[model samples]
Target: MAKEKIVLAYSGGLDTSVILKWLKETYDAEIIAFTADIGQKDELDGLEEKALATGASKIYIDDLRAEFAKDFINPMFQAGALYEGQYLLGTSIARPLIAKRMVEIARAEGATAIAHGATGKGNDQVRFELTAAALAPELSVIAPWRLEQFREEFPGRAEMIAYAEKHNIPVTASAAKPYSTDRNLLHISFESGMLEDPWFDAAADDNKGMYVLSVAPEDAPDQAEYIELEFAAGDCVAINGTKLSPLEVMETLNEIGGKHGIGRVDMVENRFVGMKSRGVYETPGGTILFTAHRKMESLTMDRDVMHLRDSLITKYASLVYNGFWFAPERLAIQALVSESQKNVSGTVRLKLYKGNVMGAGVKSPVSLYNPDIATMEADPTKAYDQGDATGFIRLNALRLKVGSGVEQNAKK
Candidate 1:
């Protein structure tokens, strides 16, 4: 009989590299290592060679940048999904995309099981497992971190390093970095390790090297940079008059926003697994886009529709953060988000200074902001009647007036 095959999500990092070798040894199976290229840039260098040398029978390094930016990042941003109102869902949003493709590779390679390096205590285990469960329930999931046997052998980074040394597996993860990072087109996140302390000042001089995407806001250029973003159906289509694809848009925005020290957030967030974790993130492009998109909606989207979308932001954000990107409720909320964005096409002018993204102007062919109706100086167009305020105010105040009268009667 052929040896049982298992697909492993390998990142060429310490954890996954060790997991690749361990999975092969423990199960005595043919290990197929898979790496998803979701805008890790130069980090993909020599990953194939490393995986093959580390005991992978076969290695698949798939480039999912376009699909990730266009399908995953775009739709999630359209819904304005932010975890804890601070996290841009950078790491959270990329999990489903990575896992979906991993599932495809597993099916194509006829692998019986899919394994990940996420620990049982973290949220990633939930995200990866949920995706696998939703996408390919037939395939079994092997979580090495969750297994007591595996955990016993390697309780922490020190033991993992020894295992790597003994097995001749090369790794970059060391005792030096107790923290971890995850990156994609949307953003890069830093957490764990030295970042666990909520009071830890990640922005201090000692931790200056931690920021990869942006300079410190204080170190930014003195002058503010201005740019215009053009949107189509709620998606950013152009920046500063240059048309760019979804990938290009994110890349360009990251460059511009990073230079201006935009999108740096440090906070302690509640994990889905009932733990509070501290994280530091750099999402330069995403921050700019979020501001521009909301400002554009202020000009184009209907008040009621925008209000309804605003109401769903928390719910949508929670769903994404909790690893339900493939869940039905998320899809339903996305439908509503998409429906409300049909007319959200416009150009927003913004001034980026230090860490601030302020709106300078906004315009759209279908903009609902009527200068004639809103002008305090003149109303020559007769777009809105001043006399209409009498009935409108009275009708709105009727309930308040009635409530006050009821209170007064009770007092009497």
Candidate 2:
């Protein structure tokens, strides 16, 4: 009988490297390693060779950068999907994209199961599994962190390193490094190690090396940088009149925002599995885009529509944060978000200075701000009628007056 083939989401990291080898030894199955390239840049170095050398029958490295930006990141940003009004949903949004491709690859490779290196205590496990269940219910998921055999054999990174050495797998992990990081086009995040302490400052000497995307805010340039962003139906199409692809837009903003020390967030967020985890993130590009997008919407969107979208922002944010990217309710909300963006076309001028993004000005051809009626200067030929205010105020005040009278009667 032929051994069952399994697809593994291989990152070539310490934990994933061991999982690849252990899966082969335990199941006597063929492992097809897969890695999604979502703008990890130099981190993809030597990943293919490393995977094959560590018992992978074959490997697939797919470039999902464009797809990640166009489909996942931008849409969430348009909906203002921020977890707890702080986190950009960086890791949470990427999991579904990774899982979707993993399912497709599993089908092509004739694999029966898909495996991931997410620990049992983390939210990635839930995100990966829920997406798998939603997309391909027939396929089985292998979570090594939840398995006692895997956990007992490799209790921590130290044992994993020992296993790699014994098996002759080339790995660069060590106890000295201590913490873990995840990176993509939108942001880079650091967790565990010294970052596990909520009171520990990430900018301290030992942890300073973790920030790869931006400089310290205090170290930024003294002068503010001004940039203009053009949006069409809520999507940023150009910066400073230069049109670029989705990937280029993110990269450009990252470079520009990093120079000004734009995006840095540190918080303890509630995980879906009933636990809290502290993480430090640098999202230079995303911060600039979020500020500009909100400012643009204020110029072009209707007041009631904006209010309705604001009311649903928290629920929409929760859906993405809680691993429901593939859920039907999320799709439904996204449709509403898309509909609300139909008229959100505008240009917003922003000033970036020392980690702050402020809107200098905003304008749209479809703007509802009527300056004629809003102007305070008196005009002899103005369209205003002062007599109209009497009926308007009287009608609006009638309810308040009746309520006051009722309260007086009750007191008497």
What would the per-residue lDDT of candidate 1 be over residues 1-412, giving only the tens digit for each residue? Answer: 9999999988899899999999999999999999999999888999999999999999999989989889988898888777777999999999998899889999999999999999888888889889899999999999999999999999877999999999999887655656788888889999887887888899998787888999989999999999999999999999999999999999999999999999999989999999888889999999999999989889999999989988999999888888898999999999999999999998999999999999999999999998877899779898788899999999999999999999999999
Task: Assess candidate 1 and give its lDDT.
Answer: 0.91
lDDT of 1 at 113: 95
RMSD in angstroms between candidate 1 and the native structure over all alpha carbons: 1.2
Name the best candidate (by TM-score). 1
TM-scores of the models, in the given order?
0.97, 0.95
Residue pairs of candidate 2 with colliding backbone atoms: none
